[model samples]
Target: MNREAGMILISTMLMLALLALLVVSQMQTVFLVYKSLNRLVDKHQSFYQLEMIAQKLSSFNNNQLQAACLVTEKNPDEVFTLLKNGKACSLSYEQQSFFYLIEELGFFPCMQTVKEKGIYSTQHWRLTVLAKDERFNFLQLRIARIAPFIRCEKKPLVFIHTGIISWRYLVR
Candidate 1:
């Protein structure tokens, strides 16, 4: 009877040790999952912010869009503050940030017959967008666009032109 009691106590201690280890491992897995989810949330927020900016840019006129692109080209690392309600908007708690660059890509002649009488010019632009969160997890996109505008006109009519995205893709 004494031997049986001793065996039972030892078995109980081993079982308790195994249970503790299992619980510890489960807690670690939970922590890892939580961290991954948190990162995913941050990335989604950054992507949403970037999408908003892209949508706004798409709506902008040629001059406004070009100006913004030039600013990005001048300083690639520039953190542009968005304007809201006539004021500069601040970043959210997730520290989501994004910037875009526009490069002059070679333009192809849309019309074969281009005489001196033709007054319209088509320009292609290569746009690169980079978005990041606080953790530096970044998303990159490349867009090719064609913008047609009148270079010079005698009339006072101000013709507005919007760029059309020819090709776009995620870089990384």
Candidate 2:
């Protein structure tokens, strides 16, 4: 081949290699971003699931369930023991495989608010919830302080009193 033609071929080969490298680098970056986004989505969904589980547990009104939770407060191991015997009263909402503990912290009068004139007593309960998903190797631990009003107001009061007072997380 002529000298000029050989020079052109060599320069073109170098440019093609550089272009391929850039494309590979870009693809790697995109793949990493996709993986991180998937992880973020998993964390977000797990958090929401934990919150929903907490809400369902806090709204429990069953006497036997409450008594069982009290048992757990004194000794958490009792929960596993009861669960093994299929006699636990702790609420499990779905087949998601989750467990929660309820501990009665204290009770006090409700906060004085401009909207509501009559303020009665409120029960302070601490709820610790743990959820596990073996498929994704995911586990989340969340703790919340929930206060459900002890007294009902006239006209069926409509509000959410038990939610998101405190939260902690453990992701694996």
Candidate 3:
């Protein structure tokens, strides 16, 4: 009877040990999941903030936008200074800062004015945005926009040609 009792006690302890290990592994998995989910949320928030900044940049006047941009080749591979106005946005994390750089890729010549009403031209612009945070999380966004502008002779009226505008957004 005593031998049988000892065997039963050992078996129970072994089962408990295995159960404990399984529980610990499950807890670790849950923690990992939580961490990944948190990172995903942060990335999503960063993307949306960049989108808002892009919209703001697109709405700026041509001259103001030109003044704020750096002219670059269509295939820029070097680093350049960002204009001071790039840091004017209010959307940022506590330990993070957001900056943007605009590059005017090309401006095609305006079509010859036949009518007295107006002349039209198309401009190609690229906007690049970067967000850096304390956690070493970095986000970059690139937007390519083709803006058509119309100028009138009578009143010096300038209008953005909304009908032919094209925009492309990319995130990295």
Q: What is the lDDT of residue 154 in candidate 2?
A: 43
lDDT string, candidate 1, 1-172, tens digits: 9999999999999999999999999999999999999978966766666666665554444565544354222232332222211122222324545555555554334422233544344544444445543333222233334334344434343322325445343423
Candidate 2 lDDT tens digits, 118-141: 444444555555664643221222
Model 2 lDDT, full chain set: 0.55
lDDT of each: 0.48, 0.55, 0.53
Give the CA lDDT, 0 to 100, for residue 28 in model 2.
100
Better-scoring candidate (lDDT), 1 or 2: 2
Question: What would the per-residue lDDT of candidate 3 be over residues 37-78, giving only the tens digit for each residue?
Answer: 998998788667656666666554556553435456444323
Per-structure clash totals for the candidates: 0, 0, 0
Residue clash pairs of candidate 1: none
Best by lDDT: 2
Please give the range of 10 consecutive residues that has the lowest summed lDDT in model 3.
76-85
Residue 107, model 1: lDDT of 38
Cα lDDT for residue 32, candidate 2? 100
In terms of TM-score, the best-performing candidate is 3
What RMSD value applies to candidate 2? Answer: 7.8
154 Cα displacement, candidate 1 (Å):
32
Model 3 TM-score? 0.63
